[model samples]
Target: MQYLHAAISETLRLYPPDTKACRVDDIMPDGTEYSPERWLEYGTCRQENPFRFPVFHAGPRMCLGKDMAYVQMKSIAASVIERFEMNVVAKDTCPGICPR
Candidate 1:
Protein backbone atom coordinates (compact mmCIF):
# COMPACT_ATOMS: atom_id res chain seq x y z
CA MET A 1 0.00 0.00 0.00
CA GLN A 2 2.77 2.42 0.90
CA TYR A 3 4.68 1.53 -2.24
CA LEU A 4 1.55 2.05 -4.32
CA HIS A 5 1.07 5.52 -2.85
CA ALA A 6 4.73 6.30 -3.46
CA ALA A 7 4.44 5.12 -7.06
CA ILE A 8 1.42 7.38 -7.63
CA SER A 9 3.20 10.34 -6.07
CA GLU A 10 6.23 9.79 -8.29
CA THR A 11 3.97 9.58 -11.36
CA LEU A 12 2.23 12.84 -10.47
CA ARG A 13 5.57 14.53 -9.85
CA LEU A 14 6.82 13.67 -13.31
CA TYR A 15 3.52 14.38 -15.13
CA PRO A 16 1.36 16.73 -13.13
CA PRO A 17 -2.28 17.30 -14.10
CA ASP A 18 -2.01 21.11 -14.19
CA THR A 19 1.15 21.29 -16.28
CA LYS A 20 -0.21 24.14 -18.37
CA ALA A 21 -1.86 26.09 -15.53
CA CYS A 22 1.02 25.92 -13.07
CA ARG A 23 4.74 25.62 -13.68
CA VAL A 24 6.48 23.49 -11.01
CA ASP A 25 10.21 23.22 -11.38
CA ASP A 26 11.64 19.89 -10.38
CA ILE A 27 13.84 20.43 -7.28
CA MET A 28 14.77 16.87 -6.44
CA PRO A 29 18.23 15.56 -7.39
CA ASP A 30 16.78 13.04 -9.86
CA GLY A 31 13.55 14.88 -10.61
CA THR A 32 13.24 13.80 -14.24
CA GLU A 33 13.71 10.11 -13.41
CA TYR A 34 10.79 7.85 -12.48
CA SER A 35 11.59 6.95 -8.88
CA PRO A 36 8.94 5.70 -6.49
CA GLU A 37 11.50 5.19 -3.71
CA ARG A 38 12.05 8.93 -3.54
CA TRP A 39 8.59 9.36 -1.99
CA LEU A 40 9.08 6.57 0.55
CA GLU A 41 10.83 6.92 3.90
CA TYR A 42 11.27 4.01 6.31
CA GLY A 43 8.89 1.95 4.14
CA THR A 44 6.10 4.55 4.17
CA CYS A 45 4.92 7.28 1.84
CA ARG A 46 6.17 10.56 3.23
CA GLN A 47 3.78 13.50 3.40
CA GLU A 48 4.74 15.94 0.66
CA ASN A 49 4.85 19.70 0.89
CA PRO A 50 1.87 21.05 -1.02
CA PHE A 51 3.93 23.93 -2.35
CA ARG A 52 6.53 21.61 -3.84
CA PHE A 53 4.22 18.96 -5.28
CA PRO A 54 0.99 20.70 -6.13
CA VAL A 55 -0.81 18.01 -8.07
CA PHE A 56 -4.08 18.83 -6.27
CA HIS A 57 -3.11 22.49 -6.05
CA ALA A 58 -1.88 24.10 -2.83
CA GLY A 59 -3.22 25.81 0.32
CA PRO A 60 -6.88 27.00 0.46
CA ARG A 61 -7.44 26.65 -3.27
CA MET A 62 -6.53 22.95 -3.21
CA CYS A 63 -8.97 20.43 -4.65
CA LEU A 64 -11.59 19.08 -2.23
CA GLY A 65 -11.73 15.60 -3.79
CA LYS A 66 -7.98 14.93 -3.53
CA ASP A 67 -8.31 12.06 -1.06
CA MET A 68 -11.18 10.52 -3.00
CA ALA A 69 -9.19 10.77 -6.19
CA TYR A 70 -6.27 8.89 -4.65
CA VAL A 71 -8.60 6.19 -3.38
CA GLN A 72 -10.18 5.76 -6.80
CA MET A 73 -6.79 5.69 -8.54
CA LYS A 74 -5.33 3.14 -6.14
CA SER A 75 -8.44 0.96 -6.34
CA ILE A 76 -8.44 0.90 -10.13
CA ALA A 77 -4.68 0.31 -10.29
CA ALA A 78 -4.88 -2.55 -7.82
CA SER A 79 -7.77 -4.15 -9.65
CA VAL A 80 -5.96 -4.03 -12.97
CA ILE A 81 -2.66 -5.32 -11.54
CA GLU A 82 -4.42 -8.17 -9.75
CA ARG A 83 -6.28 -9.29 -12.86
CA PHE A 84 -3.63 -8.95 -15.54
CA GLU A 85 0.04 -9.35 -16.30
CA MET A 86 1.86 -6.38 -17.80
CA ASN A 87 5.02 -6.67 -19.89
CA VAL A 88 7.20 -4.36 -21.92
CA VAL A 89 7.16 -5.55 -25.54
CA ALA A 90 9.86 -3.19 -26.76
CA LYS A 91 12.76 -2.11 -24.56
CA ASP A 92 14.57 0.36 -26.78
CA THR A 93 11.85 1.76 -29.01
CA CYS A 94 9.63 4.67 -28.06
CA PRO A 95 5.90 4.09 -28.51
CA GLY A 96 4.21 6.35 -31.01
CA ILE A 97 0.67 6.66 -32.36
CA CYS A 98 0.02 4.68 -35.58
CA PRO A 99 -2.54 6.19 -37.95
CA ARG A 100 -5.37 3.86 -38.99
Candidate 2:
Protein backbone atom coordinates (compact mmCIF):
# COMPACT_ATOMS: atom_id res chain seq x y z
CA MET A 1 0.00 0.00 0.00
CA GLN A 2 2.84 2.39 0.77
CA TYR A 3 4.46 1.71 -2.56
CA LEU A 4 1.15 2.05 -4.35
CA HIS A 5 0.61 5.48 -2.84
CA ALA A 6 4.09 6.51 -3.84
CA ALA A 7 3.57 5.35 -7.41
CA ILE A 8 0.28 7.14 -7.69
CA SER A 9 1.81 10.33 -6.35
CA GLU A 10 4.61 10.08 -8.83
CA THR A 11 2.21 9.55 -11.71
CA LEU A 12 0.25 12.67 -10.79
CA ARG A 13 3.46 14.64 -10.38
CA LEU A 14 4.62 13.74 -13.83
CA TYR A 15 1.32 13.92 -15.67
CA PRO A 16 -1.06 16.27 -13.91
CA PRO A 17 -4.57 16.18 -15.43
CA ASP A 18 -4.87 19.94 -15.60
CA THR A 19 -1.59 21.25 -16.94
CA LYS A 20 -1.63 24.87 -15.70
CA ALA A 21 -3.65 27.57 -13.90
CA CYS A 22 -4.13 31.35 -14.00
CA ARG A 23 -5.20 34.24 -11.72
CA VAL A 24 -6.32 37.76 -12.37
CA ASP A 25 -4.42 40.87 -11.36
CA ASP A 26 -6.17 41.46 -8.10
CA ILE A 27 -3.54 43.81 -6.74
CA MET A 28 -1.66 46.04 -9.11
CA PRO A 29 1.22 47.09 -6.97
CA ASP A 30 2.55 50.58 -7.61
CA GLY A 31 6.02 51.09 -9.13
CA THR A 32 5.73 47.64 -10.75
CA GLU A 33 4.82 46.90 -14.34
CA TYR A 34 1.51 45.11 -14.62
CA SER A 35 1.34 42.94 -17.67
CA PRO A 36 -1.34 40.36 -18.39
CA GLU A 37 1.54 38.11 -19.36
CA ARG A 38 2.65 38.20 -15.72
CA TRP A 39 -0.39 36.19 -14.67
CA LEU A 40 1.38 33.00 -15.77
CA GLU A 41 3.29 31.93 -12.67
CA TYR A 42 0.48 31.71 -10.10
CA GLY A 43 -1.37 28.94 -11.94
CA THR A 44 1.66 26.78 -12.70
CA CYS A 45 3.63 24.64 -10.29
CA ARG A 46 7.30 25.52 -10.22
CA GLN A 47 8.58 22.15 -11.44
CA GLU A 48 5.45 20.61 -12.93
CA ASN A 49 3.68 23.23 -15.03
CA PRO A 50 6.50 25.61 -15.83
CA PHE A 51 4.80 27.12 -18.86
CA ARG A 52 1.90 28.57 -16.78
CA PHE A 53 -0.69 28.02 -19.48
CA PRO A 54 -4.42 27.52 -18.85
CA VAL A 55 -4.93 23.79 -18.39
CA PHE A 56 -7.21 23.86 -15.38
CA HIS A 57 -9.94 26.37 -14.65
CA ALA A 58 -8.08 29.36 -13.25
CA GLY A 59 -9.00 31.94 -10.56
CA PRO A 60 -11.44 31.39 -7.68
CA ARG A 61 -13.52 29.07 -9.83
CA MET A 62 -11.08 26.15 -9.78
CA CYS A 63 -11.68 22.46 -10.17
CA LEU A 64 -13.79 21.10 -7.32
CA GLY A 65 -12.72 17.50 -8.01
CA LYS A 66 -9.09 17.94 -7.00
CA ASP A 67 -9.27 15.70 -3.96
CA MET A 68 -11.62 13.21 -5.58
CA ALA A 69 -9.34 12.92 -8.56
CA TYR A 70 -6.34 12.11 -6.41
CA VAL A 71 -8.22 9.51 -4.40
CA GLN A 72 -9.53 7.74 -7.49
CA MET A 73 -6.13 7.66 -9.17
CA LYS A 74 -4.46 6.18 -6.11
CA SER A 75 -7.17 3.60 -5.44
CA ILE A 76 -7.48 2.39 -9.02
CA ALA A 77 -3.73 2.17 -9.61
CA ALA A 78 -3.07 0.40 -6.33
CA SER A 79 -5.81 -2.13 -6.94
CA VAL A 80 -4.57 -2.97 -10.43
CA ILE A 81 -0.96 -3.42 -9.43
CA GLU A 82 -1.83 -5.40 -6.34
CA ARG A 83 -4.09 -7.81 -8.25
CA PHE A 84 -1.70 -8.56 -11.12
CA GLU A 85 1.83 -8.35 -12.39
CA MET A 86 1.63 -5.77 -15.11
CA ASN A 87 4.48 -4.62 -17.35
CA VAL A 88 4.86 -2.27 -20.26
CA VAL A 89 4.53 -3.98 -23.61
CA ALA A 90 7.52 -2.21 -25.16
CA LYS A 91 10.13 -2.65 -22.49
CA ASP A 92 12.88 -1.10 -24.55
CA THR A 93 11.07 2.20 -25.03
CA CYS A 94 12.03 5.19 -22.91
CA PRO A 95 9.37 6.51 -20.59
CA GLY A 96 10.34 10.06 -21.57
CA ILE A 97 9.03 9.42 -25.07
CA CYS A 98 5.78 7.95 -23.75
CA PRO A 99 3.37 8.76 -20.96
CA ARG A 100 5.11 7.66 -17.78
Candidate 3:
Protein backbone atom coordinates (compact mmCIF):
# COMPACT_ATOMS: atom_id res chain seq x y z
CA MET A 1 0.00 0.00 0.00
CA GLN A 2 2.80 2.38 0.90
CA TYR A 3 4.69 1.58 -2.28
CA LEU A 4 1.55 2.17 -4.31
CA HIS A 5 1.23 5.67 -2.87
CA ALA A 6 4.91 6.32 -3.46
CA ALA A 7 4.66 5.22 -7.08
CA ILE A 8 1.73 7.56 -7.67
CA SER A 9 3.52 10.43 -5.95
CA GLU A 10 6.64 9.80 -8.00
CA THR A 11 4.58 9.81 -11.19
CA LEU A 12 3.14 13.20 -10.29
CA ARG A 13 6.53 14.53 -9.25
CA LEU A 14 7.94 13.94 -12.70
CA TYR A 15 4.85 14.87 -14.72
CA PRO A 16 2.77 17.29 -12.72
CA PRO A 17 -0.76 18.09 -13.91
CA ASP A 18 0.29 21.67 -14.55
CA THR A 19 3.92 21.78 -15.58
CA LYS A 20 4.05 25.54 -15.93
CA ALA A 21 2.02 28.17 -14.09
CA CYS A 22 4.53 30.77 -13.03
CA ARG A 23 5.65 31.31 -9.43
CA VAL A 24 3.81 32.51 -6.39
CA ASP A 25 6.74 33.45 -4.11
CA ASP A 26 10.06 32.23 -5.48
CA ILE A 27 10.11 28.44 -5.29
CA MET A 28 13.29 26.36 -5.54
CA PRO A 29 13.45 24.34 -8.76
CA ASP A 30 14.81 21.13 -7.23
CA GLY A 31 11.87 18.71 -7.61
CA THR A 32 11.64 18.34 -11.39
CA GLU A 33 12.86 14.77 -11.25
CA TYR A 34 11.01 11.63 -10.11
CA SER A 35 12.10 10.06 -6.80
CA PRO A 36 9.79 7.49 -5.22
CA GLU A 37 12.30 6.93 -2.40
CA ARG A 38 11.55 10.39 -1.09
CA TRP A 39 8.09 9.24 0.05
CA LEU A 40 9.63 6.56 2.29
CA GLU A 41 12.07 8.99 3.88
CA TYR A 42 9.55 11.82 4.06
CA GLY A 43 5.77 11.79 3.89
CA THR A 44 5.70 14.28 1.05
CA CYS A 45 2.16 13.17 0.32
CA ARG A 46 0.81 14.22 3.74
CA GLN A 47 3.57 16.52 4.95
CA GLU A 48 5.70 19.30 3.42
CA ASN A 49 4.38 22.49 1.88
CA PRO A 50 2.14 22.04 -1.15
CA PHE A 51 4.37 24.44 -3.12
CA ARG A 52 7.03 21.71 -3.43
CA PHE A 53 4.63 19.73 -5.64
CA PRO A 54 1.79 21.94 -6.73
CA VAL A 55 0.08 19.66 -9.24
CA PHE A 56 -3.35 21.02 -8.30
CA HIS A 57 -2.22 24.58 -9.01
CA ALA A 58 -0.61 27.15 -6.70
CA GLY A 59 -1.45 29.80 -4.12
CA PRO A 60 -4.97 31.17 -4.30
CA ARG A 61 -5.47 29.54 -7.68
CA MET A 62 -5.07 26.01 -6.31
CA CYS A 63 -7.88 23.46 -6.36
CA LEU A 64 -10.00 23.27 -3.23
CA GLY A 65 -10.75 19.55 -3.63
CA LYS A 66 -7.15 18.54 -4.14
CA ASP A 67 -6.93 16.47 -0.96
CA MET A 68 -10.27 14.84 -1.59
CA ALA A 69 -9.27 14.03 -5.14
CA TYR A 70 -6.14 12.24 -3.97
CA VAL A 71 -8.16 10.23 -1.47
CA GLN A 72 -10.64 9.21 -4.15
CA MET A 73 -7.88 8.30 -6.60
CA LYS A 74 -6.08 6.12 -4.10
CA SER A 75 -9.29 4.43 -3.09
CA ILE A 76 -10.17 3.62 -6.70
CA ALA A 77 -6.68 2.35 -7.47
CA ALA A 78 -6.60 0.11 -4.41
CA SER A 79 -10.03 -1.29 -5.12
CA VAL A 80 -9.25 -1.97 -8.76
CA ILE A 81 -5.88 -3.54 -8.03
CA GLU A 82 -7.44 -5.76 -5.40
CA ARG A 83 -10.10 -6.90 -7.83
CA PHE A 84 -7.69 -7.66 -10.70
CA GLU A 85 -4.22 -9.03 -11.28
CA MET A 86 -1.77 -7.39 -13.66
CA ASN A 87 0.99 -9.23 -15.48
CA VAL A 88 3.99 -8.17 -17.55
CA VAL A 89 4.20 -9.60 -21.08
CA ALA A 90 7.59 -10.32 -22.61
CA LYS A 91 8.45 -8.15 -25.61
CA ASP A 92 9.59 -11.14 -27.65
CA THR A 93 6.36 -13.10 -27.19
CA CYS A 94 3.58 -12.98 -29.77
CA PRO A 95 0.15 -12.02 -28.38
CA GLY A 96 -1.86 -13.34 -31.33
CA ILE A 97 -2.76 -16.98 -32.08
CA CYS A 98 0.19 -18.75 -33.79
CA PRO A 99 -1.53 -20.79 -36.50
CA ARG A 100 0.58 -23.74 -37.60
Candidate 4:
Protein backbone atom coordinates (compact mmCIF):
# COMPACT_ATOMS: atom_id res chain seq x y z
CA MET A 1 0.00 0.00 0.00
CA GLN A 2 2.94 2.32 -0.54
CA TYR A 3 1.23 3.80 -3.56
CA LEU A 4 -1.93 4.29 -1.56
CA HIS A 5 -0.02 6.13 1.14
CA ALA A 6 1.65 8.36 -1.43
CA ALA A 7 -1.68 9.14 -3.06
CA ILE A 8 -3.22 10.02 0.29
CA SER A 9 -0.25 12.21 1.21
CA GLU A 10 -0.46 13.99 -2.16
CA THR A 11 -4.13 14.65 -1.54
CA LEU A 12 -3.31 16.23 1.81
CA ARG A 13 -0.58 18.36 0.27
CA LEU A 14 -2.79 19.62 -2.54
CA TYR A 15 -5.60 20.33 -0.10
CA PRO A 16 -3.85 21.02 3.15
CA PRO A 17 -5.77 20.85 6.42
CA ASP A 18 -4.87 24.51 6.83
CA THR A 19 -5.47 26.60 3.74
CA LYS A 20 -4.79 29.99 5.28
CA ALA A 21 -1.06 29.78 5.71
CA CYS A 22 0.95 32.99 5.80
CA ARG A 23 4.16 31.84 4.22
CA VAL A 24 7.43 33.05 5.73
CA ASP A 25 9.31 31.91 2.63
CA ASP A 26 8.58 30.49 -0.79
CA ILE A 27 11.10 27.70 -1.26
CA MET A 28 8.75 26.24 -3.77
CA PRO A 29 7.80 28.38 -6.69
CA ASP A 30 4.23 29.48 -6.91
CA GLY A 31 1.84 27.09 -8.71
CA THR A 32 4.10 24.12 -8.34
CA GLU A 33 2.10 20.90 -8.28
CA TYR A 34 1.80 18.94 -5.05
CA SER A 35 4.44 16.23 -4.76
CA PRO A 36 4.54 13.52 -2.11
CA GLU A 37 8.28 13.00 -2.54
CA ARG A 38 8.94 16.52 -1.39
CA TRP A 39 7.51 15.55 1.97
CA LEU A 40 10.37 13.10 2.36
CA GLU A 41 13.03 15.67 1.61
CA TYR A 42 15.47 16.58 4.37
CA GLY A 43 16.07 20.18 5.44
CA THR A 44 13.83 21.41 2.65
CA CYS A 45 10.61 19.95 4.09
CA ARG A 46 7.77 22.43 4.63
CA GLN A 47 7.75 21.62 8.33
CA GLU A 48 11.21 23.19 8.49
CA ASN A 49 9.43 26.49 8.15
CA PRO A 50 6.33 26.34 10.32
CA PHE A 51 4.79 29.35 8.66
CA ARG A 52 4.76 27.36 5.44
CA PHE A 53 2.30 25.01 7.16
CA PRO A 54 0.43 26.45 10.08
CA VAL A 55 -1.71 23.39 10.71
CA PHE A 56 0.78 22.19 13.31
CA HIS A 57 2.13 25.63 14.01
CA ALA A 58 5.89 26.05 14.55
CA GLY A 59 8.70 26.93 16.93
CA PRO A 60 7.51 27.36 20.50
CA ARG A 61 3.93 27.10 19.36
CA MET A 62 4.27 23.69 17.74
CA CYS A 63 1.38 21.38 18.47
CA LEU A 64 2.12 18.60 20.90
CA GLY A 65 -0.45 16.38 19.23
CA LYS A 66 0.99 16.62 15.75
CA ASP A 67 2.59 13.19 15.86
CA MET A 68 -0.46 11.63 17.43
CA ALA A 69 -2.66 13.22 14.81
CA TYR A 70 -0.65 11.60 12.05
CA VAL A 71 -0.71 8.29 13.84
CA GLN A 72 -4.49 8.47 14.20
CA MET A 73 -4.97 9.39 10.56
CA LYS A 74 -2.83 6.50 9.41
CA SER A 75 -4.51 4.08 11.77
CA ILE A 76 -7.95 5.04 10.61
CA ALA A 77 -6.97 4.88 6.97
CA ALA A 78 -5.49 1.45 7.48
CA SER A 79 -8.54 0.24 9.37
CA VAL A 80 -10.93 1.46 6.74
CA ILE A 81 -8.93 -0.03 3.92
CA GLU A 82 -8.70 -3.29 5.73
CA ARG A 83 -12.48 -3.51 6.08
CA PHE A 84 -13.51 -1.99 2.78
CA GLU A 85 -12.29 -2.29 -0.77
CA MET A 86 -11.82 0.92 -2.71
CA ASN A 87 -11.75 1.16 -6.47
CA VAL A 88 -11.00 4.01 -8.82
CA VAL A 89 -13.13 4.28 -11.88
CA ALA A 90 -11.39 4.82 -15.21
CA LYS A 91 -13.70 7.71 -16.01
CA ASP A 92 -12.18 9.58 -13.09
CA THR A 93 -8.64 9.16 -14.38
CA CYS A 94 -6.87 12.03 -16.14
CA PRO A 95 -4.11 11.08 -18.49
CA GLY A 96 -0.72 12.82 -18.78
CA ILE A 97 -1.78 15.71 -16.58
CA CYS A 98 0.54 14.76 -13.73
CA PRO A 99 4.29 14.29 -13.90
CA ARG A 100 5.37 10.69 -13.26
Residues 1-100, candidate 2, lDDT per residue (tens digit)?
3334444444543355663534764343553342232222333212223235323445576567755875787778767768986777898865322234
Candidate 3 lDDT tens digits, 1-100: 5556777777776666765755675445884556666665443334446688777767898889987877887898888888887776797774333233
Instruction: Find the candidate with the highest TM-score and give its number.
Output: 1
Give all candidates' CA lDDT scores: 0.81, 0.47, 0.66, 0.60
Misplaced by over 4 Å in model 4 are: 1-9, 19-34, 41-47, 84-100
Order the candidates by lDDT, highest first — what do you get?
1, 3, 4, 2
Q: Measured by TM-score, how close is model 2 to the native structure?
A: 0.34
Q: What TM-score does model 3 achieve against the real structure? A: 0.53
lDDT: the better of candidates 2 and 4 = 4
> Per-residue CA lDDT of candidate 4, range 9-93, in tens?
5666566687566568445666767666555433222333566756577789888997777677778888887897777679666
Instruction: Locate the minimum summed-lDDT window of 10 residues in model 4.
Output: 39-48
Task: Give me the displacement of residue 68 in model 3, in angstroms.
Answer: 1.3
lDDT of 1 by residue, 26-67 (tens): 476655678788887767678799999889989999999999
**What lDDT is reached at residue 94 by model 2?**
51
